[model samples]
Target: MNERSLVFFVIVLLCAGFMALSSFEMVQDYIKPASGRSVILNHLMKLTVALVFFVVFLYTDHRMLFSRPVIVGGYVLSIALLVVVLILPGGETRTHRWMNLGYFSFQPSELVKIYTILFLAWYVEKNQLFMKRLFRGFLKPLLLVSPFLFLILVEPDFSTFALLFLTVMLTLYVAETRGVYVLTFFSIALIFFVYTYRMGMLNNILRSYQIERLVSYLKGNVSEQVMRAVEAIRSGGTVGKGMVLGEEKLFVPVVTSDFILAIVGEELGYIGLGVILFSFYGLVHSLVKVVSRMQPIPSVKTFISGFAILIMLQVMVNVGVVSGIFPVTGVTLPLVSYGGSSLLATMIGFGIVGNMILESERE
Candidate 1:
């Protein structure tokens, strides 16, 4: 690997370390309340999943994913998984979002996001010439991506769906697809939005909790969890209360998952927050530079760029929600959150970028 690639990898590690540190103290009950195993195991499991996926991606050729069979099957698998979640029993959670496979609970929506990136990248590359043709190239790609987005939205995972939509759109834009195609998608999206609002279809589709969250955001009314997070940042002042000393651990909701950044801010203070955010941007920046410098196929470049955009948007939304500027998106801080699905998806996504860099350097 090149020096720049190494730097980006190191920055990823630094961010991951901080995430682990912040999440180490989460109540064991959150994962498996009755397991009787040490709570530390939960965090370790997340780390293990992340590292395994990253290493696997580093060894794999990203180009193989574009094979006709893989693309077709992968897209079908994502749709099937999304549908299966709804079929399974939701029970107390009341959200049909996960597939309980005895030992591991799988969140298909998260993995599908990664798949969507690869699909779009491949599509853009394959159809670069056909983009000007509205039906064959432009509309086809949009039609293919719609199933993934629709399933996710119906899962009531509006946050993840929103981020996914933005990333795909950005990827299409970068892929040099016709501007009119992108504009058409946006126009249809706006019309759909207005129609849903007018017909009450949006409310019918979204879960009650989601509606409440959006309402709170629109009204400028902060939730108790956000208020506690604000207090944590406020009390930290310039320096901080010190690592592992953030008192917000007692009150803030899901400190290890959704609101991990708030703990970083409280424990590491503004300077630490700056460092974390800077590392995030730096990592994404490194991806951009590596992808740009590499003499790769257009799809590869677009894939890496789209992945970076997704991570950046997730970080912004997570921080914004915690800081009271945006609604609770349930989007985790890229490498700085404590969910296996999110962490695994992030590591694999970045690993593919590394793979591209390796190929470029080899050439």
Candidate 2:
């Protein structure tokens, strides 16, 4: 398997997602009159734009893009976007998670994830010899990334922050940072978590609904949304009820974004879900093979590996939430999710990876 094969799987997943969303849109039509512009149409437009980004990144040289000055600028821009989202008005879900642009809303946290990985790849490569040291290898990198994590946490996006932090640590580990240092940082993070819990800071940080979701999950009590999702999936059985025919998806909250898999299960059945999972597996497998072959190019290898980890982490959390195994974390299902920010960021990451693959092949 190669980059082409990896991208082919992505397209398959994308098409599957579109079919699910189209089915959802058809379901919605039964209850309401057709609006001038529908969500599916808007999503299509965003998908078109996202494809442009993917192509641009695929053709562009990643080395030029990840140069010290360019990566630094992008890192600074990402931080500024994160800060702006917090300070600006008209955020989503009463949280500072989205920056409302005049035309459309943007999720700064998503962009920050990409830039953080890119910046880290550059930083790690520059300090490869010092990666095993406490300061240069671990502490400095952690400190540098702390602001991004802290700002995201303040946005009260605990899920994204947690996952992003984990991804960063994984990147550092892959870059040969001291394992003990990473472990020590985890210990400190754990202690901080305990302190925050004891101080009731968690409540202050997370919204009431978010806390409720977490508590419900911890107590083995699934929320109505998850319940509906599970029911929808189970009803699909071996083969789905049929495309656009499943009624249960209508009851699942955020069906097009978070619980889209439930729709896949309900409409296309186990086969569709299996194909989606297999495509994702293929994507990660291809990425791992690419990383292994890029041993001579440590920076590219690390960045791609980190990106792969991010995708897998989101997939697990999203699937777990839908299946009642984890709390609702508002994580999108990569290419399948309906969010423009996630789609654009993911496409850009893939394009960069594709470029790296071509470059490596040329060598």
Query: Highest TM-score: which candidate?
Result: 2
CA lDDT of every candidate: 0.76, 0.88
* Residue 96's lDDT in candidate 2: 85
- Scanning candidate 2 in windows of ten residues, the lowest lDDT window is 86-95
lDDT of 1: 0.76
Q: How accurate is candidate 2 locally (lDDT)?
A: 0.88
Question: In candidate 1, which residue pairs clash?
Answer: none
**Candidate 1 lDDT tens digits, 65-100:** 778899999988989999998788875636778888
Top lDDT model? 2
- TM-scores, one per candidate: 0.90, 0.96
Each candidate's number of clashing pairs is 0, 1
Could you report the Cα RMSD, in angstroms, for every candidate shown? Answer: 3.2, 1.6
